[model samples]
Target: MLDARREDLGRMLRAWRMARDPGLLPGPVPFRGHRSYLTQLDMALLLGVSERWYRALERGEDRTYAREMIAGVVRILDLSPRQATALYRGTGHQPPRHRAGGARPDAALLDLLHQQRRVSWICDQAWDVVAANTVAARHCPWLMHPETNTMTWAFSAEARYQLREWDTKWAVPLLGQLRLAWQRWPDNERLDEVVRTVRREPGVAELWEDTTGVRGDADDAARPMYFPLVAPDPLDVRVATYGRFGDTALRWVVLSPVDPSVVFP
Candidate 1:
């Protein structure tokens, strides 16, 4: 049964790694076009570990795989947050279900959460906000504060606190990313519900019809905009966001200030 599970996991990793294109990685695109296949050695190099060590990993040997090492493999394979979490479990370190208090967030992740000090949250592979700090609660106010999903917050009026710029140019690409997520995970019921909710919310319906594509790049005209704090005067909270996707399904997002002066003390 154990070997069978290992083989199954190995197969999953292989499939996810194969599906990605060269454009997804850093450095210039390889010459002679590009190849889809990746050897165990290639994966090892991508993870910055020894070939022998990774070989053992592929064979399903337990042998102390560091969280970062496993995380690196997850990123290389481009696993969704859910997939990454599953893969993490398949390693045999994590439990299948939570204990009474539930699993604790890793120390590094917790540190990252506290550092942002803004309205930030982490989205699991299933597109659910698995973890969110108080700032996110204040800004988003889960109690009927417009749209629930991050995309909705980017496009809806309740999202007004997040959007300083008032143009479709800014809203369209973000919408497109959400659209891509819809295409990527049709089975994600939460995302499906979010789509339905946003679709009915006043102005969002119009933007959904005319989405261009995901546009968070530096060159995009929809640059960073500051959402003013209704409570305080002269404090413009300019949010700068960052994202890191694992080879597995998880994606971590950090929202912070464009400048130190904009942060709310």
Candidate 2:
């Protein structure tokens, strides 16, 4: 906390409290204080903290506070993202992400995807295809499928037809990355389901158990792709992956067009 800005934090908190209209809220509610603004006692009870602790936080006093207590205030106050971030900073802590908020496709990330002229899409930590731009949807049809788990698609027979040397080029590297992700976030339900789903595919269970192709991400090497399809596909594509959105740990997969000399499927 900036010592000079202590009173600044207090003033902001009081102002925010006054600005909040309790009448607009739904569900069983606590009685409002004078002039219908929430009181320190009401805030304390809503935040599940002691009245003394709540008073200290309101005044931005020099006492330590738990992250949950601060997060509770954010939830109860219904702070905007900017306000939540400022509150966390004022308390000398980085803002906590709403875990479920990261689950939905981020609009800013979707904007980033469409900004690319090349084929591009974004996936969350579990490799669930959250958003793919028009080019990506057109070029990599699998991305737009209702079942857009990359692991499931990579292990399926469709991948064999789409990718040249599927086992060595695509499956190996992809499985390695999925395995590493599962190891890092073993409890992630969607990722676990992806693991189970891919294993159900023929020979994939054996592949999952092997120690080979233990890569963290895709390499820049040009790989052949083919689409015997309903529409025209991009010519000579190379895979490039970028990790953006450190908070959500979202990955951007770009298919950059290369010279025609790239290997044919």
Candidate 3:
């Protein structure tokens, strides 16, 4: 079993290295020592480890590296959330805890966000805004705030002032989604704090108390909501959610405008 796991990890590491874009490499030098794509030497330099050590791991000759080393490799490779978790498990190590401070969108998700013309953002289990595209930030400036959080922003006075039909269109559905997140990550302290903070609002506590299931699945249809920041007109948008493969706590949210004519400044 151990040998099989090591071989599998080695295969995955090779695949990731081969698939990596040379442009993603840091610094002006794209490749290390005249190699195309990411070479073992480049990964070693990036991780501050010796080439032999990195090569050993890639060859499945050694599977005794520390967790921190594995983490460094994850960062250097720009591994997806799922890939990071898999790396931990395949190496006989427990996966790291999901927390606000450690939440980050992987390279693929970041690339997708940059390519999207529609409003899109990524959030963690705590609903903390980890990343957003230009369109999302431009249309919804609040999403770019340093302390942006979906639950807090939804219940804030600013949101109430900015959104039309805040109660039916935004607040209710948000509460349901928060309830789902809380259920999935009940022990996450940041989420606990978020729930406590939101429960202090006028009717939000009651709504949260009544919310029992997840209502924000990928298939959940979008509802109409007016953004005063854009204009007085209502923009119909669909909110689609996607879960990262191994990291169920991270979500990708895309707000696709129903009308193709709508464009953000």
lDDT of 2 by residue, 79-112 (tens): 7778878888888888854332234334455566
RMSD of 2: 15.7
Give the TM-scores of the predictions, in the order they appear: 0.46, 0.54, 0.59
Q: Alpha-carbon error at 100 in model 1, in Å? A: 22
CA error at residue 66 for candidate 2, angstroms: 48
- Highest TM-score against the true fold, candidate: 3
> 2 or 3: which has the higher lDDT?
3
lDDT, candidates in the order shown: 0.55, 0.67, 0.72
lDDT of 3 at 212: 56
The best-first sequence of candidates by lDDT reads 3, 2, 1
Candidate 3 lDDT by residue in tens digits, 29-77: 2243644578888777656679999888877764578787786676556
Off by over 4 Å in 2: 1-102, 228-236, 260-265
Predictions ranked by TM-score, top down? 3, 2, 1
lDDT of candidate 2 at residue 67, scale 0 to 100: 74
Per-residue lDDT tens digits for candidate 1, residues 1-265, read 3487877876777677667553343111123355766667776666667889987777766577887777566544545657878788888656223211112234466457645566666555433344455466555544112113365555567555445554544566566666776677787666676678667777777777766544434222424444344333323333344444434344455555445555543
TM-score of 1: 0.46
